[model samples]
Target: MLKIISNQDFDTFAQNAKDAPRKRSHHNLHEQLDAGVQRLFISTEPETYMRPHRHSEEHKWELFLVLKGQLDLLIFDDEGNVTERHSLSPETNRAIEIPPGTWHGYACMQSGTVGLEIKEGAYIPTPQEDFAPWSPAEGEDGANDYRDWMSTAQPNTK
Candidate 1:
């Protein structure tokens, strides 16, 4: 069977990062995709920041196709160090494969930046993600704390 989801239908799946801790993963398209693959729609503001964390179970990778705006894909090591960064813009359609156990987070460089995320999954109850110790847990500190860490934290030598 062949299926086609229009822009309207896909937008319904998009989710907000701010509501994630409340267990609201915003506009996600997990059910629409086939097994072993889940699609998610992510939209964020400039001040929005996802705390540093890692998914160790699945080979967690994502293809972020920017629908609009800009973002910074910040990757970290086990010690919560900023290892690499990617500045993503809507100028191109691209995908970044993030390996499992790579601590990562994102900062919205511009408001209303929407991304289409595709990844492998068979959802589990517990978080396959391990949050970095040095990073503040969501709601514990303001977004500024995360930004500060990124600017000041030493890079991983490994």
Candidate 2:
């Protein structure tokens, strides 16, 4: 049976901030047809900031498509050094395919920037991702520190 799952329907199944730990919502374990692709819909309220980090394996890529608002995509290196920064607006409707082994993060520029994330996935139990040591854990105060640093930090690459 073929069924169409709208973003609204997906949101019903996703985990909101109060339901989970993060500021946005996510829906994992989608239909089997979505295998190898981790689908997510991020809410834009509260103006969340993702800390710079990378996937553990260097073989997969994560694509972030802004479905609604603006985002500042920040790329960094192994030592938590910023490499590139991009200001993305909704007019382009393009997705940023972030390669593996690259540290990256994002900040919502508007009030309702919802992003759609597609990634290669065969969810693992441990070491699923490599987070920059300079950042904080999901619930730590370090998150605030990380955001402050991202605002004034300079790019590290050409």
Candidate 3:
């Protein structure tokens, strides 16, 4: 079956993200969790907080392409300092590739933000050891504040 990705898919994802408790949603394109390559469309609202994390597996480099709205991809150092920040939007910077073992997270800059994420995987979720020790976990008291800071975080800053 040929699955054509259309505008309607994005619209539905956006609506789902708005309704989700975490303010984000994912629609997997890959048929199964064990698929060699994982692909998905991620929809996120401005309030969504993606806790900083990394894929420790050697082959897990990830790519994200913004298809709608905007977001700021924040790359961090081991000590939790922002090492790089890339603002992505369909009209400007559109994509980013994060290497495996790199600490990173993103903050949605606009509502209805949608992006395509692709990575080498068996779709294993990030493990506890891969979550940045210096960052707050999702739903933690400082998670929102940390997410807000990421929206404007500069290189060399914590």
Candidate 4:
């Protein structure tokens, strides 16, 4: 079977994200395709907190593309220091390629924000070595603190 994803597809995903408990939703476009590489669209609201994590395995690489709305992508160093933060929107700085073994996270900056995520897959759980120990897990109080900083964080400021 052939699957074609259009703007309407993303619209529905974004709508679902609004009411999603985790403040986000995903529409997989990879199942019908090959297994090694996975592609999907993730829709999120401003409240979403994407915990900082990295792929310790050398083969794993992550890519993000803003399909609509806005996002603040934050990159951290090995010791959990803020190294880079970039504001991205569909009209500008739409795509980012994250290398393996890099700690990173993002915050949705708009009501209905949708982004395309692509990576090497077989869908393994997050390893303890890969997940950042300094950052709070999803839904934790500290996570909200991170989210708040994300809302106001600039490119090079604290």
Number of the predicted model whose TM-score against the real structure is largest: 3
Choose 3 or 4, whichever is better by TM-score.
3
lDDT of 2 at 80: 71
Off by over 4 Å in 1: 1-25, 32-35, 125-129, 148-158
Q: In candidate 4, which residue pairs get closer than 3 Å at backbone N, Cα or C atoms, i.e. clash?
A: none
Every model's TM-score: 0.71, 0.74, 0.97, 0.91
Model 2 alpha-carbon drift over 4 Å, by segment: 1-21, 32-34, 125-129, 151-154
RMSD of candidate 4 to the truth, in angstroms, is: 2.0
Question: What are the per-residue Cα lDDT tens digits for candidate 4 across 14-96?
Answer: 88998899889988887755478888889999888888899888988999999799988888877777889887897789999
User: What TM-score would you give candidate 1 relative to the actual structure?
Assistant: 0.71
Model 1 residue 140 distance off true place after TM-score fit, in angstroms: 0.2
Give one digit per residue, the lDDT tens place, for model 1 in 1-97.
4556566643443344344443223465666534578776676665555777777775665566666667677787677667887777767435577
Order the candidate numbers by TM-score, best to worst. 3, 4, 2, 1
**Per-residue lDDT of candidate 2, residues 51-128 (tens digit):** 677876876688888766677788877767787888766686457888877778886556555677778876553253
Clashes of each: 6, 0, 0, 0
Candidate 3 TM-score to native: 0.97
lDDT score, residue 50, model 2? 73
Give the top-scoring candidate (lDDT): 3
Cα-based lDDT for every prediction: 0.62, 0.66, 0.92, 0.84
Q: Where does the lowest 10-residue lDDT sum fall in candidate 1?
A: 17-26
